[model samples]
Target: MGIMKDFKSFAMRGNVVDLAVAVVIGGAFGKIIASFVNDVLMPPIGLLLGGADFSNLKVVLKAGSEAILNGDAVVTPAVAEVAIKYGSFVNTVVDFTIVAFAIFMVIKAIEKTKKKEAAKPAAPPAPSKEEVLLSEIRDILKEKQ
Candidate 1:
């Protein structure tokens, strides 16, 4: 009961809710960035660097055991296989870069806003007459001693 109530209160806090929302939005933003990189940005870049598809980029390591075609060098069209896909790595790198840049910009904007907010002067507290008298007495004592 006590634990449940505490959990409820914590979950209902504004910061926690804001964080949950941010996580969801950030995930969606990452997907959008990944799609933009794979679908838009990479295509043109790949074309410019000669028509090389990043998705098909890979290293054929070992070429797998047990070759089919009954002692033939040529591999047939239909065959179960495994390949080291380095092209996917390139795509992932691009996606990471885009998402990282987006997150960096968001953090930079948030910091800028925080700095602007911090620059505003807070209201000064009213001083009491007793404090003023104490200061004056201290000054007089300093002058004398």
Candidate 2:
């Protein structure tokens, strides 16, 4: 029960909640970015590259073959194709670059707002009644002297 209570407290903390929300939003944002790259961005680029599909672009490392079966009994297991999918990597890179740029812009905007706040000169505080009275008494003494 103590451990459960501790876990609940930890999970309900502001930073933890914020982090969880961020992760969920980040995942959704990544999906949108992925869709943008796959459906919108890649088509024009692919067309420009002579109808090359970037996702399909790969360097085959090893060839694959169908599994050998003897009367519905497996003789040998099927081998999967191994390849370096550099085009997919390129798409991922583009997505990351866009996300990074967006975050940078947001941070820049926040900084600009902070700078504006800091740049403004604060108004001086009004003198207290006691201080005003003290100053008047001092002026009177000085005049008498």
Using lDDT, give the best candidate's number. Answer: 2
| TM-scores of the candidates in the order shown | 0.66, 0.80
**What are the per-residue Cα lDDT tens digits for candidate 1 across 1-145?**
9999999999999999999999999889888988898899989989998998898898886465544465566475454457889999999998998788878998999999999999999889877999899999999999999
Question: Model 2, 22-118: lDDT tens per residue?
Answer: 9999999889988988999999999999999998889999988889999999999999999999999999898999889888998999999999999
- Alpha-carbon lDDT of model 2: 0.94
Task: Report the Cα lDDT for residue 41, model 2.
Answer: 96
lDDT of candidates 1 onward, in order: 0.87, 0.94
Model 2 poorest 10 in a row by lDDT: 94-103
Residue 60 local lDDT, model 1: 83
TM-score of 1: 0.66
